[model samples]
Target: GPGAPAWAYAARRHWAALSPPLTGWMGHADPFAFAPEWQPAPGVRRLLVGTPPILAMTALAAGVASFDGIDIAAAEAKSAALVSVFAALVAARCPGVGVDAPPQPRHGAQLVVRHPHGRRVMAALIECGVIGDFRPPDRMRFGFPALYTRFVDLWDAVDVLAGVIDTGAWQDARFDRLGKVS
Candidate 1:
């Protein structure tokens, strides 16, 4: 997650017709030749805009490599299941908290919940090591990426959230002050 790469895909037939929004030396066919005009490199190389960040790319490569032999479908199912379990737990234990997503199979890999004091609640949760972010108005998002998140983590997070809400721990004045970045 720290070094995730941004990638784009185009069909082979459309490669010749496509034009890169940004043109940089790395995308040139022969960057060292000092050519008079731009000559795009063959295939997807033409889409590269700048010199690659070697360290970031290396990390990205390793991150991608870690997925080798993993079943993506199974991962998706596990993510959905984890989200479902989390939502159910929140409903049962955390009164006044409501999920803001569609049912399973329609929802993505995260759970967004709404609460009157969502921002402060999220801050308290973060303090308890259950990291989640709050969106404006009244939304808090918790991500459960199946590759890294385990089922026990979901239970722990929901438990912390319930404790924060039940004991009025989120009422701490420190949690009310908003950060520059939400």
Candidate 2:
């Protein structure tokens, strides 16, 4: 649509947004190429994104002997499977709850559930010793790390959550009350 602005096009091309009337200095080139000397002092390094093959190639090119946090191909695949299972379980057993996205373990599975008392639901879960991040109004995100999480953990979490909902424990005024970020 002609009504769309120029920044929309920039976003589609995965370029950084800039004000109207783009300048030549707006990320047109790789900054690293322009300033090779800006490489950080050698130390332990990690990258949260990029394909395994690409990350491996970069590590080899940089002569990195060891790196932490980057998942091996097999491990990532396995973790993704685990995340799928957890998401599926949550979706099946919990009403008004659904997985946030395709079940992937990039950072573990994120489950999204809708509750009128979203904050209270989250607070109750936390009190039950099941920790998950929450957003205002109504968004609860639970992460199941493949490396440390067990199938039983998922089963137990769902059991606890179902109890909370069924018992209406989340309706407690104390739970409904906001806390710092909650």
Candidate 3:
């Protein structure tokens, strides 16, 4: 138990439950693993298995994850910048008409936030193609995945969203009433 995490064996063992070595990210171990609390069935094999595409995709992700931190940071900067610009446009065109959810951040260089509004507004954005991620309570998140988002695309995304709110297009009768993962 002494000196047992990557930083030491103890820390590794600590985070092991939440983060697995799925992509070589897990190297921590604890002696209590074989205890009754945890056990792996042996001599069992499933007939349906081996998805090569999944393995290939995972390999691609691991390779990307191994990119230098500086490069990732640069990519993130571009993405956040573009997304922030979009959020600024949304804020500018559709000034908050006053929502009871506490005043939210209007805009910033690296923050692409929007204020809470009715559910129709959210579904409208999704239908427009910007994969908005929904969070609990009332927050919509957008992931401008750096490797592929362009500034023009970002502008267009927000412009369309502005139109949705301006014309009540989001009132289309199909969005789920309940909030989901963002």
Candidate 4:
């Protein structure tokens, strides 16, 4: 971390001191301390190339086609798939779960899945033994990561919601009082 900060400082200083030697300013291209004016080579790229490892030293080097460090694209794809699968499952199992994908144009808050009905739906899920959260206005976000969650869990959650909605449990008197934040 210190090294990173020092590198940034040095970069700033290097750019600051890039003027011609006739400007009479020290340009050491270093961050530790400033030095007396030194002329930089004209037409020099001044590029600090990161040292190359080229490839990992493992014997399977030839077949290493992937760079999986922080694979956000893959993560996002998997997340989308999970959400889709869960939403489908909820739709199939609990036909009355009401996704709020109504005829009206969806607000950003709707995209967030936070609505009064969203909270009720979440509470209904919880009452029937499924864990979930509700955002403000109206949103119901569920995470069902592949290689992590089972499809049966989605089914079970839907079943629970269906039961709650069927019983009108979300409309019960116990849920009448809104929370302070609500």
Candidate 5:
């Protein structure tokens, strides 16, 4: 009775409930069986390399995340330049959009814009094929990775964003409803 598997099963269930949905893909096994106390279960690879690898590369190139102490001066300069341009545009056109004066660097080359109509603005951008993440009640975030993102792309996105704000297109009732995933 001392070695009963009931305790382990209960612990597993508790962990599963707290973890993300993707954890199910990792399979059921004694996680502590590995030497390091944690390791991916054998033969249970979902996003081991492909997308994560690409995103890692992108983050490194964006000068937001460092790799092996190597500093990317160009990426840093480019990010600053882009942020300056974005801040200027946002300030000039969309007065309601709040842009930080001294932008925080560790945020990974992204602008954290807070607006009254954050969700609606995000929805409008999505409609225009400009994807952005929203923090409910009023915060929209935009990340510009210097890897494949170009100035033209940013300009175009800003143009669409400006149009949305100017036209008050984000006032749509559809944007007020919450979706499965924000």
Candidate 6:
């Protein structure tokens, strides 16, 4: 969340037609003048709402700076390769689990898989230090960020998943209790 800041972009031609739904003082052309009526600032400045979160902005700047030397194309290629390998592994070793992502180049940096006991399985994986998230009904989502995730991590994760499924480790009652954030 620190790195992922909310933003918007529009073509120069569309600027006049755009209006922020929630107008705040910061979006006024002359906020200090305290005019009787609302006068929006020019361009994207009109989209601003309220005071900026300085600390969050600082964190966002730092997060963005962290990617200064990264080659986005290379990162994307690595992500595709990692996702392909992970999907293949899941298809081969994990019998009951179904790879939910589309074929290579069509999918994103994450891989989703479906299982009957997806929630419990995800919890078990988390316990084993393999962090993943479970969506409602039957999907487990795993993000393979090219900047950090390694190829061996996918192999190890799959191995642990296979073991968990084959041994019925997800049957544990501790995994059934849902937390607020989960």
Task: Determine the C-alpha RMSD for candidate 4 after optimal superposition of all C-alphas.
Answer: 11.5
Write one digit per residue (lDDT tens) for candidate 3, span 1-182: 22222121334334424432222212213223534332222112111122335555676678667665648668767765776566666667766522222123433223334546545567767777766655545556566666667888878877777787778776677765534643
lDDT, candidate 5, 1-182, per-residue tens = 22221112234435434432333223434433544333334442321211234555565566544344545788787887777777777878776888744545655678877788888888888878888788867888887776567888878888888898888988988777545555
Q: In order, what lDDT does every prediction score?
A: 0.87, 0.61, 0.53, 0.51, 0.66, 0.88
Once fitted onto the true fold, the runs of candidate 4 whose alpha carbons sit more than 4 angstroms away are 1-78, 100-116, 177-182
Off by over 4 Å in 5: 1-71, 101-106
The superposed Cα distance between candidate 3 and the true structure at residue 170, in angstroms, equals: 1.6
Per-model clash counts, in order, read 0, 0, 7, 12, 0, 0
TM-score of structure candidate 5? 0.59
User: Each candidate: RMSD to true structure?
Assistant: 3.1, 11.6, 9.7, 11.5, 10.9, 2.8
Best by lDDT: 6
- Clashing pairs in model 6? none
Tens digit per residue, CA lDDT, model 6, 1-182: 43334677778888777788878798899989999988999988888767767888888899889899999999999999999999999999999999897767888899899999999999898889888888989999999999988999999999999999999999999989555655
| Candidate 6 ranges beyond 4 A from true positions | 1-5, 10-21
39-135: candidate 2 lDDT, tens digit per residue: 3211211111112355556656565444355577756665677667767777788787655664344454455666666788899998889887678
Residue 103 CA error for candidate 4 (Å)? Answer: 17
Candidate 2 vs candidate 4, lDDT winner? 2
Error of 1 at 23 (Å): 3.5
Consecutive 10-residue window with the lowest summed lDDT within model 6: 1-10
Candidate 4 lDDT, 18-57, residue by residue in tens:
5442222222344234455443433222233223233432
TM-score of each: 0.82, 0.55, 0.55, 0.45, 0.59, 0.84
lDDT winner between candidates 1 and 6: 6
